[model samples]
Every structure is written in structure tokens, then in C-alpha cells.
Target: MSRERPIPSNGIVVLGASGMLGRAWRELLEELGINSRFLGRDECDITDAASIRRAIDGWPIVVNCAAYTDVDGAEAFEDEATRINGEAVAVLGAACIETGARLVHYSTDYVFNGQRDWAPATAPPYRTDEPRDPVNAYGRSKAVGESLLEPLIDSGKLDALIIRTSWVYAPWGKNFVLTIAKLASERDELTVVNDQYGRPTSALGLAETTLTLLENLVEPGIWHATDGGRCAWFDFATAIAEKTESGCVVKPCGSDQFPRPAKRPAFSVLDLSETEEVIGPMSPWEDRLDQVLIQAGLANKRRLRKARK
Candidate 1:
């Protein structure tokens, strides 16, 4: 389900320490007592080669979590997103190469178009070897980063791994779980898009699993990491509301009902075969969600209510 292993002796430096994923990494590293340094955007401007080089010079493992994560906003600021998710990655990769540091970078399932002519029942998960066919600007921007980094990895010029995950959530941060839980407490009814489906990855679990991968000495290339099982956004929302023990009624609706600038994939599930082969079966998404909610004390709502009475 969840795992942790010894990290490198030279220590790790985490970028994007201000973001949700970054904070998870920080927490995990601290728990493990691994010598680590976490840097936010203000401290480390990845777009600047000098800043990137300075950050990478001493660390043996470089974990990059920084990115322009706004999916809908990317439609309007594609260039800015590209500058961060794409161009900045190129610079960071170069710095890693120069410093001889192994890189661990995160990407999204959005890199795939999430459409197929085949029957939905039999459609296979997106393999690592699949071609890039993004449906939205955010996906395209991430695809650009993959394009720049894949060549380096294939050529054996850079020692790095790119992990593609979906619907990432953590105890702290602006994520689907917290959003739905909050709304369920305030509103009587909530509508979520039912057409979209993908696996959910717990940031805490992901951070630990990532360390486990490193402990196993996996190769430098693309890999998928998410909790086991798949579900639509509505299904996930319902699970969150239930976990929080809220009275909010969750309703399903098509994506068209709540339009946004970005065109999200109907199905963005990444193939976890390779990942599972390495780390064994992942914990089910519901189990992972429960663990996280409990950690955040959201699961204690009902207990607190009973205590109040």
C-alpha cells in the first residue's frame, strides 16, 4: 500500500517546496531523516540556468515538483505555462546533467488525448511508449516538457525519471478532496463531472513510493504512479463527501454542464503495469483517500459531532 526506503547518502534537494506535492515530499524527507533542502519559487527560479545550476551543484538527487498547474488558466496563459512547465524543465535537465544529479520530475496524464475509437469497456490504459496526443493547452505544455526531457533520457545523457500521475491530492492544498469536502459541509447539493475518469494519487503515498523506487534502483525513464482502481470525478466526489461524513448530496452531471476553457480528457488513466511490476499492487484509491482524510482529521468529523452531543 504505502512504502519508504533509504534515500541516497548525498541527500536530495526538492524544488517547488511551496506547492502541495512539494510539501508532501518535504514531509516525507523530514520523517525519514534524509538530509534534504526544499526550495520554493522565490528561492529558486528554474527558468534561470544559473539559479538551476546553483541549486543542483551539491544535491545527488533532484526532485522537481514545480509547474504551472492551472489547467483552465493554461488556455489563456499557454505561453507562461510553457515557459514554466516546458522551457524551465529544459534548463533544469541541463543543470542536472552538468551536476551529475539524478532527476525525479513529475508530469500529468493530460499528455494523452484520452480518446479512442475502441469500445470504452475494452480501452487499454495509456502505455509509457504511447505517442503524445494532448487534448488541451495544459497537456500540450506538459508534452513539451516530455519532448525536451525524453531525448536526453533516451540518449543516456541525463539520469532522470519522469513520473506521470493523475488527480493528485494531499492533506493540505487546493485539491479535489478538500474542495468537495468543504463544499459538502456548506452546500446541500453538489454537481461534479461524471464523464472524466482516472486513478487518484495520494501525494504522501506518491512521495513514499517514489523513494521506494529509488531504493529499488529503477531505470531513468517514464513511469506511472497512482492508487489502484479508477473512477469518474463524480464517484470520487461522493467518496470524499462520505469520508468527511457530510450530509451533502453529490449529483452527477456531464462536463458540458459546467464548461471551462480547457478541454479535459474523458479518460486519462495511465498504465500502472510497469509501476506495479516494480512496487507490487498499489493500495486502492478509496483506501488511500481514507488514509489521507484521517490524517487531515476530516474523518473525525462524525466523531467530533458525537462527542459534542
Candidate 2:
């Protein structure tokens, strides 16, 4: 709730403003009376150093939401993914270091391999310091980006904070929640993967948390930021169906049933102990989901009307 910040008066620069998270950040900033400049892919080619420099030249704070998020396509075009996700990030990091601007970069849970034998059954949420073993090309690319910034951050040359989040969905983007909501309304039965486990975070909540971190002047380091609690994709879908009154039956299916080009972590729930201690606790996923549904105009109006009867 605290809105005071450590940021400068120059205003924030947002990269990838056309994306889901970027849009959410823009909305949140406006609501909080903060000044920001948003740049889409056309305005700033992150992979090009000159373009990145032009975008963040005078800005004192930069929030990077751009990423090569095509998990399946990354298998065939790892080079493209690397250029955008890895190399581009390094370029941005270097530029931020040169300008002395605070950089808030986003990473993914895919950085870890699905096999967490350390806590097999209910695999404990991965800790921030845990070893990263990316299984697929997309994950590897993200890991490469994280590695590129490590030395700069360690040596106190770059003022940066990396936040690793999972299964992020927003009202305005192509995401799992929106997909499921649409499918449930049209289909009589829907099948979702039950083996995959992680928290579904709302982009709106994430944006608020990022602002809170800035307001508190939290230390520059890697942290996990997601809605509290976890569930399988199937469970998440069922919740969506129930909330929207879509009258669709959600069935659980094994991950092996539907193959994907990129191997996703079976259990990538991130440990939020450090994040909670530093920036306060996040709302439960169920609560955040309701808010998102209301914003998207997909809440269970039929159910509510029936109850009123």
C-alpha cells in the first residue's frame, strides 16, 4: 500500500509495452499517478544496442517485460530466442550500467529442469539459490540471460533486480486463463494437464508487487514473485470453468498425453519466503483469479443471478 519510491523524477521507461506484463505495468503506473514511457517492439529493438540506448538514454528506471516466449518455437529457433532473451538482455544490462539506471528484469521458472528429486512427491518450490538446470532451449536461453547479469550485479556495477515468475496471465494477453475461459464457453469438455504444477500469477498483482519493492528500496537481487499457493493446470482450468459458469467439464490428463516442443517443469512452484519477507505477502491465487475474471468480464454472472432467484 505504500506508494513512496526510491526512483528518480525522470519517470520510468517500459520495454515491450505491447506485451501482457508491460500493459499491466502501464495501467498500474497510471493508477498510482506515476509517469512512464512505454515502447513497443517497433519503437525499441532490444536486440539492437543502439535502439536500446535510444530508448533508455534519459530514463532513470527501466522495467523490461520483453521476452521471446514461444516455448515450442524456441526448439526450432533457439538462435532467435537467444538473441532476444539472452543477448538482448545483456545489452540492456550493459546500457543500464553505463547510464546508472535501475533495471528490473523478468525471468521465468523454466530456468530449472522439471526433475527435482530433492523433493519428488510434492516438490518443494525452488529456492532462489537453487541450482538451475534448464531442460529445453527456451529455459536455457533464459538461464544464459541470468548468467550474463550475475557478474555485473555481484561487482556492484549494475543496479538491477531479477524477478523469476511462473504461469503469468492477464486480462489483455494470450495466456492460459484467457484460453481456458474461451474454450470452456465453447466446448462441452476440456482436457488440461494435471501433472504440471505451479502457481498461476496475475500480471496485475505482479505489477503492484514490483512497485512495492521499489517503494521500499529492496535490495537488488533475484526473487520469486507469484500469487500464493499452487495447482496443476487441470485444477486451474476447473476453477476457471466454475467461476465463469461455462458449464464445461474439465478433465485431467497426463502431460505425456499432449506433447510440447519445450519440456516444462513438472513442479516449478517458486519459494517466496525471501520475497514475502522483503516485500510483503502476495494474495492467494484464487483471490487474484476472481479479480482477473471480473476485469475480463468473465465472472460467474449466471451463477450469481441464479443465487439471487
Candidate 1 C-alpha RMSD relative to the actual structure: 3.1
Model 2 residue 69 distance off true place after TM-score fit, in angstroms: 0.5
Each model's lDDT comes to: 0.89, 0.89
Q: Each model's TM-score, in the order given?
A: 0.95, 0.95
Instruction: Tell me how many clashing residue pairs each candidate has.
Output: 0, 0
Report the lDDT tens digits of candidate 1 across residue range 1-309.
334555667899999999999999999989888899999998898888888887878899999999999999999999999999999998899889988999999999999998966554357888998998999999999999989999999999999999999999999999999889999999999999998889999999899878878877799999989888888899999988876879899999999999999999988888999988988998889888888888898897556446336
**lDDT (10s digit) by residue, model 2, range 1-309:** 566655676789999999999999999988867788999999998999999999999898899999999899999999999999999999999999999898999999999886767543467889999989998999999998999988889889998989999999998889999999999999999999998888899999998888788778878879889999889899899999988889899999998999998888888989999889976688989889888988899995555446436
Runs in model 2 lying further than 4 Å from the true structure: 118-121, 300-309
User: Looking at model 2, how many pairs of residues clash?
Assistant: 0
